[model samples]
Target: MSVNNIHEWDKGEYNITTDIKKIDRTAVHSYLTRSTWAKGIDFETVSYSIDNSLNFGLFHREEQIGFARLITDHATFAYLCDVYVLEEYQGRKLSNFLMSCIHEHPVFSKVRRLMLFTLTAPWLYAKYGYEPVNQQNYAWTILRKDMYL
Candidate 1:
């Protein structure tokens, strides 16, 4: 499924958009490079990843403030990663709205599974129906802490 069109969602004074052109690579790189999982990642690498993923950018006016991206084929599965709302934007329920837009996305409507790996904010994700992968189930990873650094 080709998701080439922009999808927009609004709430109060903010908006979340799937318009790749609206993503501020500088802001995304700046935030993720300091984040726990993507620490040490560079701008070029971040840009490359964004180019390949289905991205959702949370914006206030014209500024890019929060973001999440999904690596998926628009069918069977999706890996939700690079999810965050800048500290100043936290506590406004923006993350919740972001998650709602993601889960309700037409591209993900038939997706069989969605996965995310987070070391913090489990409570936030839990509210969107995300839970721990049962250890006994088919889950595995070769998680490199700083693969691109």
Candidate 2:
């Protein structure tokens, strides 16, 4: 995918791209390992996951500064997860830009629901049409954790 096609959301400094080849898993692994929310991630496993996912990575001068993943069936449900921006690259609004690309993508546009879980940054996602769902009503089961590992 061409970075030029990505819509500039929240200023034009960031270039969002869905092509996972542009992702630097090493850099992302370093960032995730340092993040409190992602301390459990295994870089080798993450590298494999990114290699196989319908994921998007945000770039600033060839660096993998931000990332988000889409878990989807190409018809119905899509869960957005592992959204992160590097510490040095934060405050540049790349998350919003990356999200805009995902939301606007042809595949995601047809999805019935987009779900995400965040321990922090609720306000940031709230502005992008994400709201808290009553967990009591929407129960989730983890079908496979070992597969990713």
Local distance difference test, candidate 2: 0.74
For residues 18-129, write the lDDT of model 1, one tens digit per residue: 9898899999999998998888898989999999999999999999999999999988999999999999989998999999999888877888999998988999999988
Q: What CA root-mean-square deviation does each model show from the true structure?
A: 2.3, 3.6
Tally clashing residue pairs in candidate 1: 0
**Tens-place lDDT digits, model 2, residues 24-53:** 888878777666656657888789767766
Candidate whose TM-score is highest: 1
Model 1 spans with C-alpha error above 4 angstroms: 1-4
Once fitted onto the true fold, the runs of candidate 2 whose alpha carbons sit more than 4 angstroms away are 1-13, 142-149
- Report lDDT (Cα) of residue 10, candidate 2: 30
Which candidate has the top score in lDDT?
A: 1
lDDT of candidates 1 onward, in order: 0.91, 0.74
Q: Residue 33 deviation, candidate 1, in Å?
A: 0.6
